[model samples]
Target: MTITTPNNSFNATLQDLIEYPANGINSTVLLKDNNSQYSLFCLAAGTNIDEHTSTRNAVITVIEGSGNLNLEGKDIALTPGVFIFMPANAPHAVQAKENLAFTLALSEHLPAKKGVSQKTIDIVKSTAPVIKQHGKTITTRMYEIMFDTHPEVKSQFDMAAQANGTQHAKLATAVYSYATHIDDLESLKAMVDKIAHRHVATHVLPEQYPIVGECLLKAIKDVLGDAATEEVMTAWAEAYQALAGVFINREQQIYQNAS
Candidate 1:
């Protein structure tokens, strides 16, 4: 399912990079203009792209693969159809469990400046302090807490997880990532468009938005416990509403565009 728009410049071809040993990760740049960048990367089982940070926020979609994404400090399992937002200048890393392919899109419009890339071990030394102090890191913890406390929400993902399809995992990661990087309205819009398309594929009704909302609230409550202040919950809820609204609006636009 390749989507080429009149305004989109993304271009690339999937290739076999490894066979016997299934080692190393390779990337083929799809688009690299002044305003935006895109690429497809292939990785072999057990391969990794050690902890690294980017200057701009990146939206990553797992096209085909099994892997675990370490964002901030939490581990997120990723598979095909999953999307994850890597916030600007945030320390992140990847570990591939099987042959995998993924796509990444980054906006040049964000304000953050880039720092030098460090190896996986050296990464903590450079960015750990800031990540620990930053509020954004809490979201990763909240995700784990949410899943642990609200096992019912896990039911929403059972079918996919059982089949190793990572659609829900991707949506969750992308939503969290985009929420943390809301400085650019366009980035948010792109995130919405992606989510809308994903919903169409999964037959996800608009009503599922509330289910996700409740799961998020539960996660926050579990993570922060008594400290889950009203102000904090409200802010997160507002972000969720905005993101869901984008999904709904874009879904409508997609129908209109088709007609």
Candidate 2:
């Protein structure tokens, strides 16, 4: 069963929602949204759920009865109050040693909060001309630094594009565009959507955003030297995080849709 409220909030007793079928299992979706799914499960004695894998991370809390959970080849006894966390794609199976009831919460990794201060927007916009002039150099240096420091991520990039300088040039243009439209982000919706799709296709993870941001900031400081003042660097860092937040959120939505 599903519950919908006008305010998008509700509270219900888990025991009231549970229904144990004789020699079978029952599941009720308590809530579901883009980021998460909350469900209540009831299993009759002798019931067994075959091993399986899930695309989203999950947590299980045993509310009543007894069971055994085999997670990634490890057997975990499940009794009242037992809680288990299962990472995405980990194989798991469940058997009811007695009539069992549990709560399963599945969720995707959420992106960091996103918002750029007005001061940061102004600073980034004011530096557009300078960034435009040295954008290519900074981006090229950024890729070099990133590859040198985080060699594991090298496979995600297109070596051919990097060798031909096309990738850096493209990033330079994107940087300039962002600076020009800092205050009018709606104008760059198409470009942002295109890049977000490309990032999802390339399997970019939210954790990698900080790595790229670090490398890009270092490259900016190296290329601009004294021109990259403390304030400027700080503003750019904030701007990059805000931009990364956008990409992370969009990519997450795409992943949720695909799943």
Query: TM-score for all predictions?
Result: 0.38, 0.59
What does the lDDT come to for candidate 2? 0.86
In candidate 2, stretches whose alpha carbon ends up further than 4 angstroms from where it belongs are 1-114
Per-residue lDDT, model 1, residue 84, is 92
What is every candidate's alpha-carbon RMSD to the true fold?
Answer: 19.4, 12.0
Task: Give all candidates' CA lDDT scores.
Answer: 0.60, 0.86
For model 1, the superposed segments whose C-alpha errors exceed 4 Å read 1-22, 112-259
Error of 2 at 80 (Å): 23
lDDT of 1 at 76: 86
Give the per-residue lDDT of model 1 (tens digit) for 1-259: 2244436654344444322244786666665544566777778888978766664579988878688999999998898889999876577889889887888898754432222222322322332333234333344444455567556555544454534535434544564455445444475666667767766656554435555666656665565566555755665555555555566556655654655
Residue 99 of model 2, lDDT score: 95
lDDT of 2 by residue, 114-166 (tens): 56889999889888999999999999999999999889999998999999999
